[model samples]
Target: MDGKRALYYAAIGIAVLIGVSIVVSVVSALLSLAWAIVSGIVSLAVLAGVVYVLYKTGAWLLGGDDADYSASDSVGGSRSASASTDAAAESRQDRLRRQYVEGQISEAEFERRIASELETEEPDDVDRKVADIEQELERER
Candidate 1:
């Protein structure tokens, strides 16, 4: 087995051994009870320390919670996926057209904005045009 799986098994074995030792002391003999309790406590403490050290040192690893794993896994391909982006652009254009048709924005203003967006004649003016578009969208709302 891998080191990680071995560590997990070792941890469980330590826990079970501690429990069995305690039980044997209580039932089989009272003279060993004190020793058993002390040994059990010490064993468990050492097991915990070993587990923690293995975890921190990258020797042992466990999977995260299912919900978190599922969430992040679902989003794993999102950065490279363009499925929703085209729909968003179409929706934005539709909203702009609707606003113009509803008399919220003038035809001349809409044409001017479209020209400014599509022509790309001035790289320096892109930011200003984007700001203007945002202001117009805000006003439409």
Candidate 2:
């Protein structure tokens, strides 16, 4: 009777496991179906957007607003962007000179700053190059 009871418990445990597995598999299948539907919707939306862009681009190449793009006509200004940057640099140099003449900055500081602006090379870069050359010369010796 003891052996029979043990066998019965083992059979019951297996039955419970089978039931739990069936429920889990059913839930997994439902989740997979939901994911497939959501992905299909997203894919359709992306495909539609791609088609619209292509159609508008082709229309623009032909120089007619056939597809009716929502974006405004122009993306750039008339003048080159670098023109303002160059003017700003010239103004800054003039200001630096004026400040130095007015005694607002020391002569040494003014000279160093002017060199930095004119050369566009960092002081550290100069130091690094000198170190490299010295190392090369030492290796040759």
Candidate 3:
């Protein structure tokens, strides 16, 4: 009878130990998951901070005006404001040519408009235009 009682206690002890081990494993897993979540959030916060700092620094270095720089200017060198004006003039000329070719304007009207366009050019641009005309004439010859 005493031996049976000892066996019963031993079985209970083993069961208790197994239960404790399972509980410990579950708790450890939960803690690990919590730690991973916290770590991920912290990492994202740090990344965002880094990006913001970089953005502020870049803005400061670029005179704090975002509009002053363009993506094309970054890829190539910076262009003067006059260069944009010249581009606008070129676009206008292209539109005029298209209009003339499409019969929206007569030949005499086209010539008059083109002469007016050339007359409105900046003084500095005139030399360039003359050079371009000379080059075209040479190419024709």
TM-score of each: 0.23, 0.45, 0.45
Candidate 1 vs candidate 2: the lDDT winner is 2
Q: Is candidate 1 or candidate 3 better by lDDT?
A: 3
lDDT of 2 by residue, 1-141 (tens): 999999999999999999999999999999999999999999999999999898888887553524332332222112233323444443454466557667798767766775666565446644543354344335534
Tens digits of lDDT, candidate 1, 32-65: 7777999999999999999977675552223222
Query: What order do you get sorting by lDDT, best first?
Result: 3, 2, 1
How many clashing pairs per prediction, in order?
Answer: 0, 0, 0
- Model 1 stretches with alpha carbons more than 4 Å out: 1-85, 119-141
The model with the greater TM-score, 1 or 2, is: 2
Enumerate residue pairs that collide in model 1. none
For candidate 3, write residues 3-98 as lDDT tens digits: 999999999999999999999999999999999999999999999999988997788566453434433232233444564566656556556655
lDDT measured at residue 21 in model 3 versus the true structure, 0 to 100: 100
Instruction: Give candidate 3's error at residue 16 in angstroms.
Output: 0.7
Prediction 3 TM-score vs. true: 0.45
For model 3, the stretches where C-alpha displacement exceeds 4 angstroms are 64-141
